[model samples]
Target: MKVLIPSFYLILFLLISNCSTNETVIEDVTEIESVYFPTVDGTNWETKSINSLNWNESQLQPLLDYLEEKNTKGFIVLHDGKIVIENYFNNHDIESNWYWASAGKTLTTAISGIAQHENLININNKVSDYLGTGWTSASIEKEQLITCENLLSMTTGLDDSIGDSVLPENLQYVTDAGERWAYHNVYVKMQDVITQASNQSWSNYFNTKLRDRIGMTGAWIPFSDLSVYWSNTRSMARFGLLMSANGKWETSQIIPENFINEATSTSQDINRAYGYLWWLNGKNTYHLPQSQLEFNGELIPNAPSDMFAALGKNDQKTYIVPSKKLVIVRMGEAADNSNFALSTFDNDLWEKINLLID
Candidate 1:
């Protein structure tokens, strides 16, 4: 009986030790499963296989086929900051550079945030403070009311009907700033604000503050009066990943987390699905560009509710879904006949993505 008692105690000790060991192992694995960040100096990026993710591998081919059919040039899906699906079609390859069109506006948003964090600029300050008076053709009294935040939120109250030009003459006042939301080119002027505040060229400041920091290779090319940004698909993905990480690149807080949260959230009441130059999904209603009409519905019905995107003309998209830990980049020609940022293609594309990820 004495021998049996000692054996039973030994068995209990072994069981407790094994359980404790397993608990420690689980904690270690969780810590190791952190989001991956690609090296800033090289072309090397880690990839994860669909089978390893235990995703609906069968749905992947269909998604690729659909993208190709829709004139897609490049498509990428990053899960936990690691590439899960990367493809190029229609004569496009990994090295190809494409214009970001309106999606580039988000770059301005991020730069503005960084500038504000550096105390170089204040978004709440009147636009005239940076650009000086008469920057807009509005009466000085009305123009004085336009703040940098107004531009970021598309509440500039500038007449967008003057066309997509930010010249002083084109920036006519329509109403008091913050009284309405109109997606206009006036937001581009924020770049000038940044340049003037930082006392450096826009490109130089952007490169030093953001591009180089995140290892993104892109140039802001002046197209007519508009400044358009262009970069390779992976660079766009990197920016998206940085945003998904809440403005962090590895350990560096390239942009303030509070600013990122504010930028992704609804910045104004007129457009529930619009942020600071970013488009949000899962809102109860949304407003589109060039139109004041309010459409009642989620921005993209099939996409995850937490998804916010940088959508550009000709279908340039960088969709960040925090809940799913995904940053999806799609750069290509228009998926359909629509030339606007939001189109029928978004819903249809999400339909396919839903199948693979669900």
Candidate 2:
């Protein structure tokens, strides 16, 4: 009986020792850092291979094939600030320029932040301060109530039924500012306000404040009264990387950190899924463009809960996922006949992306 009792105690000791060892091993594995911030100069960028990250190459090819079948012009995925996967289809290459469509709204939002940082413009100030009275068809009283923040949040109370144009005639007030949310051309008017307020042309202000600092090459082309930005696919990726780095390029702070936080968080009460001009995921509710209906879920359910995206017409996208340290950019024709901004393609693409990473 004495021998048996000693044997039982020995077994119990081994079991306790094994349990403690397993716990320590698990903690060590979790402690390893997952994110890497790449060095940035004027133009050079570092890259990492999928194999190095232990990403599933077998699934990557299938994702690329799907992008090709969907008419994707360019696709890039950055992990830990380094390019992990970049593919071009339809004879498009790294040098080909593509339009950002409405996705460029995020760029405008970022530039506005930079301008505000320099004290050249204030988003809380009335738009009339820069554009002056009689700028809109609304009465002077109603127009005075519209601030730059209203434009950024798509709550300018403008009639969105008209065509999307920056002309004063198109900016007819349908309701008092701060009482409604409608995505319309009034956002373009913000360009004029910025230009007038900063005493610089729109291109000059944007280039000097943002594009040149980050080594991004792009041009704002006039299109039917809208200033759409065009850049190479890599340029889009660079912008995404900068955003993922919290509006910093290497050691320099490009956009103020406070603005970056506000721009990625909910900007208005009406749309919990929208921040400034960016679309936020994992929100309880969302409002789609050109529609007053509210959806009850995250903007892109397949994407990471913390992901925010700059969506554009015909599926152009630049997604920044901070939790994963990921930045994904896609420039392509319409994946489906959907709205100008949010559509089923966003979820579909993220679905494929999840599969590749998993």
Candidate 3:
């Protein structure tokens, strides 16, 4: 089915173009920055530019070599805002675009924050007001109560689930606004909310605020090979930087602090570790294993928590650990749900660093 690009979305692109009209050219390009991931279990940190973030490029040297040995696809790390580790096995590169899968939900949700800041939409505002006629509300819950806030928290009580491969649009209004914890496709389809509310195409909204602003330079391809959105392997690391910095990019506040708090912090009481569309470690479902697991096994139940992440199927990830002042990213085939391919890699990477930095 073809998605009808909303006129509101068109206006946003025009606005972006207009900003560049007088003296700038808006081009869709990508960049990969180096990052350093040091571990001390402490927040105090500093940045020093170097050719590489030479900590544990080889800590799991055998493991990395092994994955490549299998012709695996992608992996990249951003430590302390510098690229510490990166490589492609079979299908990967700076321009190699891949699906964020469920990770796309975090990104799309982030753009909603941008839309709010731009005054194109309001998180507290009801969806019915903006969606016009095509919108439908079946729940007894007043459409007025169906604010963008409800959608972000995954409390809309619809049948949305990450485990399920597909969802219908009706999930948006299946019950009272905040009665359940089902992950709904309505969150994604709420692009209609974004579209109707912000009056912008999801792509344009992402390109303008997220991709273009922070230099994600990746395509948001939900469908169409190379079509959902495209970017290189390292392009994802930039997103980890955005969350770690709390929406500020090089000093500018790309997203409001409140939005970041709401998005990364679990909004629904039902899932204490879910925020917006991102998964947090403090939640029960995020327990880490040890020995080969050997991680600190800490959870961030509230703000200032150590680790928050945008995780997706097949084990794609952009992890933000504020306490360590680190952002790590991994893209790969789902090896096991118990420990995504990056689990041991994450633990070993930290353990190796703790040996030096701590």
Candidate 4:
């Protein structure tokens, strides 16, 4: 049996098998680039050095001593878009303003998807066509079967213990619109239905369609029957870095990448963790807020299941996690069993932020 090969090694083994099949067809046509949008002007955000991402800065003072024993006053994370971590605790720093109670309903669902991308408004119409028909004591054909996509997916069956007062005798009717799933306060009356379908004045349409086009200072004041937005935790991490860049700020778009991907993904199927007011986090199941109880899994089961949050009422947070491009912010007061937006201290603050980024 003889072995014969050399004809210049058979053209060098077919040129190393066509360069390993053209490097796996150029790594399957590449493409994973878009995410660095910081330039809102206020202070030019850009800071990254957790020992250059080799991290483990001994897991940073035990994650700032577990956010100063959970009474944290301002903490930030932001990764790919810069700023590794930021802290403030107790005496609170970084210009402390705070108050996104109800996480400003995800900034009024990104200013009602920028007032439906400037056509002025239409989350599938009908919230009595911009506050008309007796607003909501039901019976006007169940208040024209409520819409504005059932007030951004809390499924306007209404009645979440009639608490956050939208007035027409506390917006009653507990079972009609889209069956049931409650997180009420009638979502602050969808800011008077984007100030009557954009006659402009929900703080001037959220400061000209989103806090003066993203410099996001913040206001929304009057809180008692709902209306609190406040600011200054780096303006809520610049609105969670403009929703972790999906609502863009660098190349502009400003909020309408298909309406922040349908306002952060899942809108409604009776709370598959919710969206349009953004909460979602790997939804298999979830429903809370004066509970009709469903809770199956992943609402924040220790974060990063493509995490999305706005969570407020004393645990005020931001957290946008595009597979770890991450943007996290936490503002002060009430964590020891906070309520309104979620708490078991949000799975113990994502298990101490997964022991500092796992």
Candidate 4 per-residue C-alpha lDDT over 125-193 given as tens digits, one digit per residue, 9 for 90 to 100: 888888889878878998798888778888889787857777888888878888887888787777888
**Full candidate order by lDDT, most accurate first:** 1, 2, 4, 3
Residues forming the 10-long window of minimal summed lDDT in candidate 4? 21-30
Clashes of 2: 0
- lDDT (tens digit, per residue) of candidate 3 on 108-226: 77778888888887777776667643343354354456667777776654444333332333434545777666655566645766766656676776787777776665666545221
By TM-score, the best candidate is 1
C-alpha positional error of residue 208 in candidate 3 after TM-score superposition, expressed in Å? 1.7
Give one digit per residue, the lDDT tens place, for model 1 in 4-39.
235678668667878774542212112336889999
TM-score ranking of the models? 1, 2, 3, 4
* TM-score result, candidate 3: 0.69
Q: TM-score of every model?
A: 0.92, 0.89, 0.69, 0.35
Q: Rate the local accuracy (lDDT) of all candidates.
A: 0.91, 0.86, 0.60, 0.81
Question: Residue by residue across 114-226, what tens digits does model 2's lDDT show?
Answer: 88998888999999999889888999999999999999989999899888776888889888998887877688777888899888899998988888887788799988878
* Candidate 3 or 2, higher TM-score: 2
- Predicted structure 4: clash tally: 0
Q: Indicate the residue-level lDDT of 285 in model 1.
A: 98
Q: Per-residue lDDT for 333 in model 3?
A: 66
